[model samples]
Target: MRCWCGKGNDTSVKTVGVCVRKDRVSPASSTGVLLNNAGFDYNVTRDRQSAIIMFCHQLNLSVMINANNPDDVLSGQNVTLDSRDIYLFSPYLVTNGRFSSLTDWQQKAVKCFNKTIELGIKVACQATSNSTIAATFNMTDLFSQAWYGTAMYNFDYFQATDIDLSGMTNVVYYFPNLNMNYGTTWQTPNVQTNALSTHYYRQTDTNTLHVFGDGLAYGNGTLTQP
Candidate 1:
C-alpha cells in the first residue's frame, strides 16, 4: 500500500506529524521518501532545483526543511519554471489546465477567433438593412483586424449602398444603391444605367471622390452630379 506521503513502498515511516523524518533514517533518505511519497518522480538534479522548490511550495512544506539539509537540495543552477513544468512536477497547482508555451496559448486564441468569424459570417448573411449590418458588426468588433476586414469586405457585397455615411464629411457618394459591379470601370452618369441614383453633391477640401464598392476607390471629379 502507498504511504500517506505518496511513496510507493511501506518501508519508510512518518513521525511527529511531519513526513520530513522517519525512524533513524538519514536526511537524504527521508527527503527522498518525502518527495516520492508526495508524487514527485523527477530526479533531484542541479537544473531541477527550482522545480523541486515549486513542488515543495505546492505541498506547503516548511522552507526550513529545504535549508536544513544541503545534500538533498541541489544548488548552483538557475532555471525558470513555466506553467508546463509546474503542472508536470506538481499537477495540484494547476486547477484549470496546462499550456506548454506561448505558442500553445496563441494556437488556442486562433481557434477561438476562427469560431467567432464563422458565426459572424452567418450573422452577416441574414442582415437585410443598415441597422442589421451594424448590429452584426458589433458582434465581431472585438475580433482581430484580419477577421473584421474580411467580414467588412464580404458584407459590402450584400449591402454596399445601405451603408450610412451620415457623419462622413469627405464622402461625396455613398451610392444610392448597390448596382455598381465590382472591378468594372467607372462610368459617367449620362452613360450609366442607374442615372436616377441619389448622388451626394458636396464641395470638400479636395476634388477626391470616395466610392465604397467591393473595395474603396478614389478619383478626381470622375463621379459627377446629375
Candidate 2:
C-alpha cells in the first residue's frame, strides 16, 4: 500500500503508515527515484522527514485528492514493509466480508488479520510467516478510539467537538480532509485533531504529524510545519 512515515518530536522514524479510501489511480511519478533518493538523499534520523517528503514528491500524492485508498496507494508500487503499514480507511466503506470492498484481487488485503495469531501459526508450521501484525493492532487502536470515543458517533450530524482522538497510541494522525470545504467529500470530516507534530511541512499528504488549536485543527497556525 501507499505508505508515509510520520513521527513525534520525541519519536524516531521507525514505523510507516497509510490511510486508505476506495478509488482507482495510476501513479505519475518515478517510484524508482523515490526509492533511490529516500534514505540516501537525506538523513532520516536527523531531518526526520526528508525521505517521506521525497516519497510524496515522487509519487505525486495529493493527500486530499489522489490515491485515497490503501489499494490505490500500493498499486503498481513494488514495495513491502518489514513491518506492516497501518492503513486507515475512510469510515464510509461497507464491510462485506468478501474482501471485495477492502482490497481488489491484485493486492488481496483482507479486512482483519492478527499479527499474534499469524506468529503462532508460523511457529506451528515451522515456516516464516512473512507477515507482521503491527498494522492490525494499530488499526484496532485507531478504530477502537474513533468508535468508542464517539469520534464519528453521529456521522450524519457531525460536529468537530464530538470527535476525540486523544486515546490513540503508537500512531500520529493528520486530517487534511477533516472539515468539508475544509474536508473532501470522500475524505475525513468533523473529527478534531488531538495532538500533531512536525513531521513534514507537507500539505495534502500523510506523515504530516501534529494537530493544533481548538481541537478542530483549524487556522494558519495549524498549517505551520515544525
Candidate 3:
C-alpha cells in the first residue's frame, strides 16, 4: 500500500502510516513523507535538538563559536568547560536506543527557514546601503547613509562589536517612558560634534536584535526627523 505522501510502503515496517498532526510539512508538500511512528513523541527529535543547540549557542554568545561541532566536542579542542553548554546538550542524547520526541523534524524546518530569511534581509539591507554610496568617500555604505539622514549630530558609535548612541531620535526618544528595564535611567550620550553622525548604527528593537552588531536594531528604513 502507498501513503498519502504518495510513496510506496516502507515494505519493512508493516504497520507504519503517515502522520498529519498540524506539523512537519515539507518544502514540496507533494513529495514530503509524513511517517507515523504510532506512539512516538516528535518533540524528542526536532524541538529538543533545536532548543538545545540554540541554548548552547546562547551560552557561548561571548565566545562567538558553535559548541556542537564534534571537533570541539569529542577532541576537547576549542571546547570551553561551559557547564551551561554541557547541561543543555547532554539531556538530548538518545538513551537506550530511544528518544522522547519525534517532532524535531518540524522544528528543524522552522529554524532553517527562519535563519534563511533573517540572513537574506541583512544582506539585502547592506546591499541597498552600498548601492547608494558615492564611491569616492571610501567609506562604508551604512555609515554614509546615516549621515545624510536627520541624525542631526554624532548620536551614535559603531564598532564591529558594539554601538553607542547619543542625542535624541524618535525611535529611542521614548525609551525613558517605556517602563522597561532602562526606563527611568535611560539617557542619550552627550555627543560633541556632528562627526559622530558618520557612524553606522544597527540598533535592536522589541522584535529583532542585530546580533551581528551588539544586539541592536537596524532602524526601520532609517528613522527621520519630522
Candidate 4:
C-alpha cells in the first residue's frame, strides 16, 4: 500500500548513478548534497496511453484502455490525471469506493440504512413480545422548517402567496410570519416584543441543556417553557 504521503514505494534516495562530467576532474557525488540541491521538480509529465500502462505496471496497478486503433500511442506528459476520467479497468485510488462517486454512494448507503431500519422495525413489530417495545419517531418538530416564512412557495403549475402563519404553530420561529394567527407567540429574546416571555421551546430527550425554540416543546410537553 502507498504511504499516506502519496509515494508509490518508500524507497530511500540511494545514489543510483553518478553523473560524470567530461571536463570536471573531481567527482562530487554525495547523496545528501544532491538531495539538498534537488531543484523544485514536480512530476510535470503528461502521460499518454502507453506510458499509463507502463506506469500502472511499475506502480503495481492494473488499468484498462480501449486500443483498437493504431493511433492509440502513449503520448502527453501532464503530471496530474483528470478527476473526471477513471481508468476503465484499473481500480485506481480515486475509483476505490470512498472518494469515487461519494454522493451516489452516500445516497444509496443512506437509503439502504433507512430500508434496514424499516425492516428492523417491521420485524420487531411482527415478532413483538411483552418485553419488546416498538416506537415510531418523527422529526417534525425536532427539525427546523424547510422554508423561511418570509419566502414564497412557487411551482411550475402554480404560485401561492408568501409563507404565512396559517398552518404553523403559535410560536414564531427564526423566520418572520406575515399573517398573524390567534395564538401567535414569540420566544425569549424576541426581536420586537419582550412582554411575552412564556415562549415554547423543544429540548432533546437525551440532553436537558440543549433547548430549541419551537412550538412542539411548549405544546407537546417535550420541553419546559418559562
In lDDT terms, which candidate is top?
1
Task: Give the winner by TM-score.
Answer: 2
Q: Candidate 3, which segments miss by more than 4 Å at Cα?
A: 1-62, 66-139, 144-222
Q: Write the per-residue lDDT of candidate 3 for residues 1-226, one digit (tens) a residue.
A: 1122122323221122122221343334432221222111222232223322333243232111112221222122222323222211111112111221212311222332233333221000101221122323214323322222212121122111001111122122111111122122212322111232222222222211111111132221132211
As for TM-score, the candidate ahead, 1 or 2, is 2
Cα-based TM-score, every candidate: 0.15, 0.19, 0.15, 0.13
* Residue 144, candidate 3: alpha-carbon lDDT: 28
Better of 1 and 4 by lDDT: 1
Give the per-residue lDDT of model 4 (tens digit) for 1-226: 1101111222222211122122332234311111111111222112322233333343333322211111121122322222211111111111111112222322322332233233221100000111211121112321111111111111001111112312333332232322222122333221111133222222222211111233223211122222
The per-residue C-alpha lDDT of model 2 at residue 14 equals: 31
lDDT by residue (1-226, candidate 1, tens digit) is 0123322333212222243332334444333222332222423343334444354344443221121122233223443222121111111101111112222222332332343344231111111123223323322211112122222222222122112322333332232322232323223221111132212122223321222111112111122232
Local accuracy by lDDT, each model: 0.25, 0.24, 0.22, 0.21
Candidate 4: clashing pairs of residues: 45-77, 45-78, 46-76, 46-77, 46-78, 47-76, 47-77, 48-75, 50-74
Q: On a 0 to 100 scale, what is the lDDT of residue 96 in model 2?
A: 14
lDDT of 2 by residue, 11-97 (tens): 222332132221333454322111211221232232333334333443444321112332332322332221222222323211111
Task: Tell me model 4's lDDT, rounded to 2 decimals.
Answer: 0.21
